[model samples]
Target: MGTTARETDRERHDEVPVLEAFTRFLGLQRGLSPHTVRAYVTDVGQLLEHLGGDEDADPLARLDLTTLRAWLADQRRRGMSRATLARRTAAVRTFCTWAHRSGHLAQDVGARLRSPRPNRHLPTVLAVDDAAQLLAVAQDRAGDDDPVHLRDWAALELLYATGVRISELVGVDVPDLDAGERTVRVTGKGDKDRVVPFGVPARRALEAWLERGRPALAGPASARALFLGARGGRVDPRTIRGVVHRLTAVAGVPDLAPHGLRHSAATHLLAGGSDLRTVQEVLGHSSLATTQRYTHVTPERLLAAYTQAHPRA
Candidate 1:
């Protein structure tokens, strides 16, 4: 009895060993976040499934520019977004390079693969007055001294004050704060650490949370966590996002997630005369190019600068 073509294909495309090795490389060597490692592994798994091997050949050995293009085309046909396509292209290239270096393939076939540029849209940011109004609303809500309200208020304040990602913010521990200096030490992407300063308002909010709020919610599971869920475990990112959305709706401002607060902070910092390099450091962005996106100035500011500096204006 002969095997069916589908069974043969499945046998030739065994991805377990390759995926496990690549997972280790991505996590241990590349130091990618768990989420990122999962994404890369998923992309590579899809690629291998798309290009099954011959009877005696390794599946990855079949990887080539033509097959890579065909895979991307199939993804496009399935209505994948441009951003997803670009990320998958990058994943395949990285995987091929690793495969070659690890002796799984003769060469990095995906080295020549190119990704379509993803659309670049400016992030949503609040106006200065709107931000102040939003904070004021949050402050008013926290006046009741409710533990959850205090935590939410402090979280919002710290988010805008430091422009840290929601993940970084939730990952904060009690010891990460330098109360005297009004700074918080955050772990950013790729596990890089940086210290960012907060304003007096944020400091007051944090103090209230630490002194009055956290104690009320502390439990055996709380440990050193800076924020706690209703059940006293470390706060989740989705919870923080919910807090932002609910507060924004009550504040009558633009409905914003936590990242919107970050965008607003970065924009306000640039508008307030902070240098790009300083903003880059404050935000813990690995590249100055990422920080440069916040440099877009309002027409009023541009005109003011032109009028102030232009000789003929």
Candidate 2:
């Protein structure tokens, strides 16, 4: 269903040279990773596709507030998620601003383009007791069990214990873990690296699996990845997701995933009176505003506390 090179060439009439040049500029000047660059390119591609393929149409010249608004409306009609719409809006705005600065366009059409405000949905997290139960199950599975089962158990335990992303969890290498310091170095989004500490439970599970489980499964040609597939290459995020989903289902929790564990960790930390800044650092959130949302308490909890102490009540 993907477009072929011939199909793309056949469809392009007005070739906007500036767009390609700008994309290359973003790659070279911004040092954005390949994955990030691809996303930005895709965002801009949607705009170009909207403009149609008329060679004489001059896509950049046709761009205006009306055109931009129409594009956004069409996206909404297509049922794009708010987060996705926001990201695409940012991409178009940035591209237009850059084009004007570089003298490619006389006016920045995207200047007035406002991104849709994303809905503020509170993330769901497990209760502390449920999190404990999940970890206990992981620990139980890690002891002298099947090698594959033990590795999966350790992987899930670390996720619940540290609340790291599935990508970050799989990105962890063997050398990055400093057992003496009780910290593991993780590379998060935008290739940012941080050291996150795990508790005794996670540490013990990891130690047992690393010492026993990994060796049994790792063949002589196995790679040095911290987590491995059956063939001994690095574990993929999908694999991690599947493992967590199945294990959480066995615990009788529906709709739990690796990210829910992350939310649970942050929520529990805030509820336990851990400082907001510390939780932000643990989660590697880029903005404090993002970290602050986890601190919101429900009215029911507040009313329960008030009822216990109010003299009039």
Candidate 3:
């Protein structure tokens, strides 16, 4: 009739192992990236901590819609952004589904959970002429003698040319590039690899860096890294961002992040008549819907181009 000491000990012992098991399942079974798996574990860990990790109350047995909503509300009250709440909501939903499939729960309580949609903000991008002028200036600064300048030029060209994320850009190595074909093999999210091509300008910049620039900067730690920092180590994303910001300011445009170049590349591609699916593959977007955002940036440019060129008016 009464609660026993052995039952309480057993309940306490169950909580940690289940969470650890779920983590292993995420990495080994689901093939989730380390970053994504860590996020899921953190999201669920916070909820479990919120539920007080009761020794007598199992998380799977006690979890339900009400408690889930209460946790979300608490996070909101603590000033978590709607976007974060939405992400956490998705994470929990995924965890619940996984738990159900693993037989930890009799039902999927998160099937009906909901969170506020994050506002869709259009990405900042440069106009076509601004992008050209910025690169031109970078090219001028990249005069043959300076390895840093050469590296900067190649980085800027490759970024705008291929639209790879800063992380992917930094991760590139000498072996990744195909010189004659002018393509680079990039490993994107979930460790998926794809070959992306660049045009003549990017190829030339890369050649200059690889031939003249990289050799000058190469040190013990360089190890075939495509980009290098001041100390001859692999370049970091922050250094890349600083380069973009400084270049844009000199180009007489608003200081922009490296990602703004990516946005510019996507927008320019669409304005130049690239189809959506083609753009999607070039951007390495997993969803066609995610790639559709660039379509919004193209209509005004299209109308402007049409108005100037068409005789129908």
For residue 236, model 1's alpha carbon misses the true position, in angstroms, by 0.6
lDDT of 3 by residue, 41-105 (tens): 99998887776665666666778889999999988999999878998998899889988998988
Candidate 3 segments whose C-alpha is farther than 4 A from its true place = 1-20, 53-56, 300-313
Model 2: residues with Cα > 4 Å off, grouped in runs: 1-37, 102-104, 217-223, 298-313
Ranking under lDDT, best-scoring first? 1, 3, 2
In model 2, how large is the Cα lDDT of residue 227? 82
Candidate 2: tens digits of C-alpha lDDT, residues 99-128: 898986799989989999877676567887
Winner by TM-score: 1
Question: How many backbone clashes does every candidate have?
Answer: 0, 2, 0
> TM-scores, in order shown?
0.90, 0.82, 0.83
TM-score, model 1 to reference: 0.90
**Position 63, candidate 2: lDDT:** 80
lDDT of 1 by residue, 7-33 (tens): 886666678888999999999999887
Worst 10 residues of 1 by lDDT: 52-61
Global CA lDDT of candidate 3, please? Answer: 0.86
